[model samples]
Target: MIIQKEISLKPKSRGFHLITSEIYNHLPELKEIKTGIAHIFIKHTSASLTINENADPTVRSDMETYFNKLVPENATYFEHTLEGKDDMTSHIKNTIIGSSLIIPITNGKFNLGTWQGIYLCEHRNYGGTRKIIITILGER
Candidate 1:
């Protein structure tokens, strides 16, 4: 059996937004199924999906800082400023980060590391809603 769901995320800043619970909620529907892997995919170009720390807020903050340093906005060489300085950089950030993620689900539970979590990294500067596609595959 295969299951799919969508989750919406509202990011305040241009950074990672944890979305484990939303993904977890979709897993319960697959309880009757024997066992399979859960694949979480994000449908967007300027944003990305990633698996990161869930324990500490500092981890997220640090990552946010890291992205800033890695892809600083308003670089002199950037000319695609029609949407603002962060436009091209945001797209670049997404390209490197990626657009989808896959996670394993065992015994009807997500097989994640102790501190691991699934996050939707919004590379955009402004806040908006992002959609995530969750797909669960298993045997009924």
Candidate 2:
């Protein structure tokens, strides 16, 4: 079976945010799947998706800090800066991180590690609502 849905996430500041629960909460179909895979894709170029530490909030903060340092805004060579200083940098960060994730599912639950969680890599300063397309493929 294949199920797909698009969800809008509340806007967030530029950072790495744990959205594991939020994503799972939107997927009622997941409960019916005995085993499968979940494909989560972000619909914006300024944002991306990833999986990482879920236990400590510091991890998220650290990730944001690291990425900002790695991809500073207003670079001289960036041509896509009409949106804002963060615009071009956001795209670069999205490329470095990615725009989607594929995770295993089992017994109606995501097979993530104990400390693993889904993260929305919001790179823009005022990134509005993010739209995610979640596709679940599995067996009953």
Candidate 3:
């Protein structure tokens, strides 16, 4: 069986946020799936999705710092600055991170590592509520 759902996340500041619980909250159908793959896709270009350390908040903050240094805004060569200084950089960060994640579902739960969690990499200053499409393919 294949179940697809779209969920809108609350607005968040520009940084990496652990959203594993949020995803599970919106995807109750995951509890019904015995074995399958969950595909989580974010419907935005200025943001991204990834999996990383979930235990330490400092890791998230450090990620933001490193990414900012790596892809600083106002590169002078960016032409897509109509939105703001973060426009081009956000898009670039999105590209570097990604737009979706594929995780295995086992025993009605995500088969994530002990310290691994899903992250919503909000690259823009005001990205607003983000939309995520969750596609679950599996059998009961």
Candidate 4:
């Protein structure tokens, strides 16, 4: 079976946010799947999706710091400055990190590691609601 839906996330500040519970809460259909794959694709170029340490808020902060350092805003080479200092860097971060994630599902739960969880990397200072397309493929 294949199920697909678009989920709109609440607005978030510029940071890495753990969204595992939110995803599960939005997709109740996942409970019906005995085994499957959940493919989440972000609709914007300024944000990204990834899986990482879920237990520590510091990890998220560190990730944000690292990305900011790695992709500094208003670089001399950037020409897309009309949007804002963060616009181009946000796109760069999104490209480097990624725009989607595919995870294994078993018994109606994500098969993530003990410390792993899904994250929504909001790269803009005022990134409005983000949209994600979730595609679940499985066999009951």
Q: Model 2: residues >4 Å from true position, as ranges?
A: none
Model 3 stretches astray by more than 4 angstroms: none
Clash count (model 3, backbone only)? 0
> How well does candidate 3 match the true structure in TM-score terms?
0.98
Model 4 lDDT-worst window of ten: 74-83
lDDT of each: 0.78, 0.93, 0.95, 0.95
- For candidate 4, the clash count comes to 0
Considering lDDT, where higher is better, how would the candidates rank from best to worst? 3, 4, 2, 1
Q: Which sequence of candidate numbers ranks them by TM-score, best first?
A: 3, 4, 2, 1
TM-score for each prediction?
0.88, 0.97, 0.98, 0.98
Model 2 lDDT tens row, 18-121: 99999988998899999999999999999999999999999999999899889877468888899889998999899999999999999999999999999999
lDDT of model number 4: 0.95
Which candidate has the top score in lDDT? 3
Displacement of the residue 33 alpha carbon in candidate 2, Å: 0.6
111-133: candidate 3 lDDT, tens digit per residue: 99999999999999999999999
Q: For each predicted model, how many residue pairs clash, with residues at least 3 apart or on different chains?
A: 0, 0, 0, 0
Query: Model 1, which residues run further than 4 Å from truth?
Result: none
